[model samples]
Target: MPLLKVVYLSNNTKLYLWKITEDFDMLFSQVKLKDSSLARLESMKSESHQKGFLAVRMLLQHNDYSDFDLFYDEFGKPHLKPQGCSIKDVEISISHSNDFSAIAISDSKVGLDFERLKEKTLRIAPRYMDVSHLKNLSEQEKIKKATVVWGIKESIFKIKNEEGISFLNHIFEEDFSFEDKKATAKLIFNNKEEKFQIQFDSVEDYIFVCAFEDVK
Candidate 1:
């Protein structure tokens, strides 16, 4: 399916999502770039926006001819162009599967992540997830909830822009049920507890999880 239309996360936040098909080459050939300037992907750190840009423009065959370009601020954040896009202070994120590319833009400093569930991820769960977040997991069912638990914490850390937070030390989930199609995460960021709701959709090989800021 084509990427979902951008949604309103809040007055200042917009969300965009996409699902890529296995025929990626066919998909890439579809972007409507008659001619333009844009760097190749070998340089950028893995981001969904890059792939989604080509995929979305290919699907739209945009007439605006707005080329995609990204720059990084000193603190290390990607800046998007076309100034007329959406939110001005928008923080963006992208995630993709072997076949899918999803992107979301938000009003606050935000982070998002995507992971293909593999035995390795399962094996490393305890290393990245907080014990408190998994307290609700029954010993038997914990195995099944493994990915759900890991995704939430990883996403939180991504949003915080930090790596050594020790999921066991800081990641915590309040009242949430990943099985119910959504869950709530309450983790400490910058020593401040910022809580948010995470929604998920289960696909063939990977799970897509999103972390959002509270909007007034």
Candidate 2:
């Protein structure tokens, strides 16, 4: 399928989702990949991974960019080359799971993470998040909320893109209602603490979360 949905997280930030329904050959034919990307694609052991990689390129092209405009930093975070003389610097974060790939672009620092709801996430919740938040929730609701918390931590890590940040020891998500679809979190690391604004929602059995540095 084509671009599944476009979500405007804020005035300057937008999230794009692509549902993967096309075959590897079809997807591969739709986008132009840099030689290095092609090599990386060829090295992928799973066809699903190859399709997800190509789908992200497809998303870049949808926004008037191509593989050529993308690069990664030493920390392995994806970055988009400056579009031109535009004054606004664009930052991006990417995530793909099972059958959907997502990208978030913003004028300021941002992070994005997508995850399919799974029972295992709830079972492993104590290792990474505050299990107290799961109190009073039904089993299914627990799974969904746990997945959101997982995405929240992953998203924040993507923004910091730093080494030695532990989700369990360093990241803390504020308690939130599943209906609210949004929350706040804090990262305490390296003798300092930083805050982030979080937005999340359920999308066809998956939870996508975005985090922005709290400038206030």
Candidate 3:
């Protein structure tokens, strides 16, 4: 079985996304999922990894590269071929749900994350969201909006590679509204500042979160 949708995120940024609609068994044969990572996943308990693999393979379908040939870094980060360099410097992140798995690829550095976006919202809400963000939310804006904020924070974290960053401290959405499908976030790395564009989307009941940057 093959996934139903592929999203092209950046024409300039070299980013692509795919949504999986296939089962794990069929998903494996379609792309080259290099190394023991595929085998190791079987021993792990990550539903996200399983679904993410399917989502990522869907993107590989359009590229010239094979899954068996692709590999990650010492940090377990994906190493993609760079454009015009005889290699495509495409970085990726993948996520999955019961129904859909989301994949994101980029020419520049990119990061992505996905979660169920429920009960966990309350516990982490105050940790990352600032007072201004909280004040803007309606009493009814608890779950969905809160989760989006968390998604934004996670997206930024994916780029920074840091842990223990608080939504209340390190980052915040610039002009976010849960009603909209998109949000932009700001990140501070040393004295340099970066902006992240986030889009919250769903395939069936699953949430797909994406984040990216273009660096010189």
Q: Highest lDDT among the candidates is held by which one?
A: 2
Residue-level lDDT tens digits of model 1 in 1-216: 665445454575554555654254565566534333245543446545456546545423322322343344565555454346554634666555555555555556566665666666656767866445456666534543567777777667667656557676777766455568677777775677777677665565666667765443
The better-scoring model by TM-score among 2 and 3 is 2
lDDT of 2 by residue, 1-216 (tens): 889999999999999999999999999899998899999999999988999999999999999999998999898988898877875557999999989999999988999999999999998999999999999989999999999999999999999989999999999999999899899999999999999999999899999999999999
N/CA/C clash count, model 3 = 10
Clashing pairs in 2: none
Q: Give the alpha carbon lDDT tens digit for every residue of 1-216 in model 3.
A: 344666665673433445555666766666656558668667758665676765566666666556654567766666665546455556766555454555566656777666565656755676678536656555546666676677777777777766455557667687566668787888775556777778776544445567766343
Clashing pairs for predicted structure model 3, backbone only: 32-67, 32-68, 81-87, 81-88, 81-89, 82-87, 82-88, 82-89, 128-167, 128-168
Kindly report which residue pairs in candidate 1 clash with one another.
20-100, 31-58, 130-167, 130-168
Candidates sorted by TM-score, descending order? 2, 3, 1
How many Å off is the CA of 143 in candidate 3? 1.8
What lDDT does each candidate get?
0.58, 0.94, 0.63
